[model samples]
Target: MIDIRDFHVRYGNNHVVRGIDLAVAKGECVGIVGESGCGKSTLLRCLVGLEHGWQGHVAIDGKPVGQRRTHEELARVQMVFQDPFGSLHPRHRIGRALSEPARCMGLPHGRDRIATALEEVGLPAAFADRFPHELSGGQRQRVAIARALIVEPPVVLLDEPTSALDVSVQAEILNLLSDRRDERELTYVLVSHDLSVVAHMCDRVLVMQEGCFVDQLTPEDIGAGRASHPYARHLIAASFPDAA
Candidate 1:
């Protein structure tokens, strides 16, 4: 469902993402893991149309998308950012935020759609009347998920989705995402530094370093500490220090 070729992103003279080529199939979850400044998130930004300066060929759902996208094209792909609070408007009510996308797309049944979206994320419909500040981090993240799903997009890009939440709540959010994917048959591109999260949620893991894909592994490889690439081995070892 997603194809990227020879992708490169530059900030002035410094190149952050270099020659990336990747393909993600429909209904499959792919995880990208790397250290800070490795351009993992930058790649996502380019895919979701947040960053326009990237140079590459990117095709989503078999259609090439330029820097400018139509509402229909934009609605086909959605993103759940790292920080829910930061992504959501501080003043907007949850219902308003949830309805905006559909409203912009001229989709009907806004009220019923908002209720269903909240329920799908394990949130009470009553919460729609509340603000972002009124909800817990987990709740806010669920609302973020709901907002992304309300548009009924085929592709969702998650960037460090559970990193900001408490550890106890992290599993719940991840499980919710997993369940949603199974129920909806959605395609996901998950970006996370946590191997445990990647292993739990992704079918394939791509190891990125210095803005390039150095190795790829399955969840089983992560559990067995079997990686051929030096950086992949280092990452696995670091994540499992007891085994290392």
Candidate 2:
């Protein structure tokens, strides 16, 4: 459902993402793991049309993503950003926020849709009446997920979806995401620095370094501490000091 070739991103002289290629099948959850400044989030920005300065061929759900996306194209893929509080409007009620995408896409029955979206993410429809600041961190993130799913997008780009939440809340969000993916058969490109989160959620994990994908591993490989590249091994060692 997603494809990219020779993807490169630059901001003037600093080339953040260099010559990266990726393909994710429909209904597959792929994880990109790396340290800070590794260009993992940059790749996602390009796909979501936030970083149009990128040079690459990015296609989502069989449509090529260009500098500006059409309404349909915008609805084809939605993003759940790293910070849920900042992503939502501080003053707007959750219902209004959830209805924005459907509104933009001209989708009908927005009220009912918003309610359903809330339920899908384990939030009560009544929460829609509340504001972002009125809810807890996990509740805000759930609203973010509901907003992403409101339009019924085929692909969702998650940038450190659970990173900002408390450790206890992280598992709840992950489980909610897993259940939603299974129910909707959604394709996900999850960018995160957490190795354990990636291992628990992704089918295939790509180790990234210096703006490139250094190695690819299955969850089994991560569990067994099998890493071929030096950086990959280093990452594994840091994440699992006790692994054999």
Candidate 3:
């Protein structure tokens, strides 16, 4: 339940995201993959209202998402950024970070919300007392995910959700995301440079290059290493060099 038409973003003369059209259905997990400076994350920032200086259409579920979003609208959509450690404040404890969204949205049951969010993300309830530095890399990411879902948003924008974690921890986080999506019927737009990560989590993959989509691949195509675009093929080779 995201719709974009002719979306474009520019920083001075540099048009980072140019003339893009995309639609993601409800309860669908779609991934945008590309190299650095491809505008993949820039597009995501625009979706969640972080990048306000954008042109063209951007609507969520039916309502247009402009530079300013209402509190209710923001509560309906949330984002999980790439670096969990950096996203969370070093001074604030876990419980405060998780409950802040619910508080801002004026949602009740702050304690219950924090507790349930931690549980849903496979974290212990006592984690609320812990600080970010005290937790491992994976735990920090879990806290980030829990923070995103604490407000019970329908659409979640993920920016390289697993990139900061170790391989073993990355798989755990992926499974948790899949399970949470099933339980909540979430609509996710994930951005990552890793095709394998996208293949495992997304129903479809959009290959982006030079600020636009060059190709679209299904999970099957990604699994089979059948990339149509040269960029997509290169990505496959880079991610799995031995197999390629």
- Among these predictions, the greatest lDDT belongs to 1
lDDT values, one for every candidate: 0.93, 0.91, 0.90
The TM-score of candidate 3 is 0.97
Residue pairs in clash, model 2: none
Clash totals in order: 0, 0, 0
lDDT, candidate 1, 1-244, per-residue tens = 9999999999998899999999999999999999999999999888888889988898999999988888988888999999989999999999999999878877753677889889999999999899999999999999999988888889999999999999999999999999999998999999999998999999999999989999999999999898889999999999987644
TM-score list, all predictions: 0.98, 0.97, 0.97
Model 1, C-alpha of 206: deviation from truth (Å): 0.4
Tens-digit lDDT track of model 3 for 134-214: 999999999999988988889999999999899999999999999999999999999998888998999999999999999
Show where candidate 1 strays beyond 4 Å. Answer: none
Give the per-residue lDDT of model 2 (tens digit) for 1-82: 9999898999899989999999999999999999999899988887877878888788887777787888888889889999
Error of 1 at 87 (Å): 1.0
Estimate the lDDT of model 1.
0.93
**Higher-lDDT candidate among 1 and 2?**
1
In candidate 2, which residue ranges exceed 4 Å CA deviation?
Answer: none
Model 1: how far residue 228 lies from native, Å: 1.5
